[model samples]
Target: MNNGKPAPYDARVITHYGVLGLGFFPQVYYYWYKWLDGRYVGTAARTVVKKLLLDQFVLTPPLLVVFYVSMSVMERKTDLFEECRNKLLPTFKTSCIFWLPAQALNFLWVPPAARVIYVGTCAFAWVNILCWIKRQDY
Candidate 1:
């Protein structure tokens, strides 16, 4: 069923966001950031360190797991868990490499109001990757 076709188009498109949750993380990051750093001397320095490194490190692991698993299930893979296992590490490693600089720039420059849109916009490239990952024949 990983044929780039889903019984329903809505479900298919939304599934790319099964793990990513369209706007959820951005909202979470936006709100949750304030609570994290305890009275940092400089806001700019805190935003850079906290947003770039801490957020990514904490979210990446669980996000990868949900992404692989949800994607496999959404694609209707017969071996759902197997598909997740096969793709998890590879995709996660790639995401780590790819998102590091992207997030750094995001935190450094992009305004909080636009961060969700920023990450979601960046996720277009990731959508291509998801397309390829799900396209694999099992």
Candidate 2:
């Protein structure tokens, strides 16, 4: 609005009903992380960093790719890869800052059974961030 360019609303990944599906991703991924992370409990700091870094480096890239490409499809765009290229870096950097401490809390203190719910709470906020990111005029 300030810049005179209309905010790109429809291209956002977290569209009205799309939020429900995106919410499922974090919960599901949390369960998958719990299973994949297994029972090898390490030093508290080390374990938190491991979980954060793995989630950052491994999970985020693929998810960003999927998110951008899928959002493009939802937008009825022809060039999905272009959408990914336009949004990936800024989104990934912001995601790192946001998710690092969020996941650290989940890994360190949250019980296994509540992990999904814990992350779902954070995901609720993150979707807002994603909406903000996707709507930027970049």
**Which candidate achieves the best TM-score against the true structure?**
2
lDDT of 2 by residue, 1-138 (tens): 459887766535436336544554766586677764684364388777877787889888888888878767777888868868988999999999999889888788887777778877997799779878878977
Over all chains combined, what TM-score does candidate 2 have? 0.79
Report lDDT (Cα) of residue 20, candidate 1: 62
Backbone clash tally (model 2):
0
Instruction: Give the C-alpha miss distance for residue 23 in model 1, angstroms.
Output: 8.0
Q: How many clashing residue pairs are found in candidate 1?
A: 0
Name model 1 segments beyond 4 Å from true: 1-47, 136-138
Best-matching candidate per lDDT:
2
What ranges in model 2 sit over 4 Å off? Answer: 1-31, 39-43
lDDT against the true structure, per candidate, is: 0.66, 0.76
